[model samples]
Target: MNPLEIGSMVKARYKTGAYIGRIKEERGKFYLVEVLAVLKHPQQGDLHNPKETEGVFFHERRALAHHEKANIPKSAVSAFTDDIPDYPASLRTALQQLREDLNGQPASAYRDLALSNMDSLEKDYFG
Candidate 1:
């Protein structure tokens, strides 16, 4: 793969979320990216524990704000050629998708916990 140039738009996985952003700088094995839109909302609940609800801290993970910068590993970044969606619209879509995916599953504590966290996140996002 060709090395990505600085200022190029990219699709990147940063932690538990995916984002569309522009590469700001390349540092060793990482690229500094400026978030333009969210492709997926960050997963809630303890990262290490994943879907567990018992004996673990449930958490809220917000999508990166527009223009927010994060250092993402090179392997997680790829060129994004499509038109960038508006941050608000993209975030709402991602959140709705996650909620729907959870809703599709048979009811479980993990699903319930994730849905509950999404509810709070939605409230905070819009209000």
Candidate 2:
């Protein structure tokens, strides 16, 4: 499928809930995104290691695109969605493996990191 078509919904690897956004293209790839939101993180309150907190506090319209593996930032992500049918055993297995890999990490960690990185990229590229 042409990835950059408008009205297409894609799931970001980190952002939960199906990201119902349109696809945008840059140089030569597609990104799926929705209205941007301000994300906040709670302060850890550690003296030795100051805690960091952030969250989606503001809403802004934005677009996302997919980049080639080599061109993608260390932070760039692959699209995800729940539309996959139940018959794809191999794909399901791979997803299961990924779940296993993330099983032990704190749930908030993924959102915190992905949102932060996405914010930085947005500012750098679109600002």
Candidate 3:
């Protein structure tokens, strides 16, 4: 690859990929680039906010330009959650018992429940 010159637009490939503004400074094999456009990746949070990441230094292997092409395809990135717990049968049984207790209540008791539901709605929405 040709050495990058100052004030040249570039597409830098990292975990995902990004298009950036002109090259600012160089230190050995790394370039300090002004971030322009951040391409999205599935596993990562939003990196496109310029206020958050103003500029970044990238190695030559990760930095590219319009004239050049990537030799290897980008690696697949993803996020996975493995700690989610299953709902217990005891909790289900407790819910069933609560439903049964409510079902046996008289009409006036249900009226009170209805008023409680309305009160909850008012407190949540109007407060």
- The model with the greatest lDDT is 1
Report the error of model 3 at residue 98, Å.
43
User: Candidate 1: where is the Cα deviation over 4 Å?
Assistant: none
RMSD (CA, angstroms), candidate 3: 22.3
What is candidate 3's local distance difference test score? 0.36
Candidate 1, TM-score vs. the true structure?
0.95
**Candidate 1 residues 78-118, lDDT tens each?**
99999999999999999999999899989999999899989
**Cα-based RMSD of candidate 2:** 13.5
- Residue by residue across 26-122, what tens digits does model 3's lDDT show? 5455555554433321111123531121243211112233233223211221121233221232223323343354356665533344334434433
How far does residue 32 in candidate 2 sit from its true spot (Å)? 5.5
lDDT of each: 0.93, 0.33, 0.36
Residue-level error in angstroms, candidate 2, position 4: 5.5
Indicate which candidate wins on TM-score. Answer: 1
Clashes counted in candidate 3 amount to 0
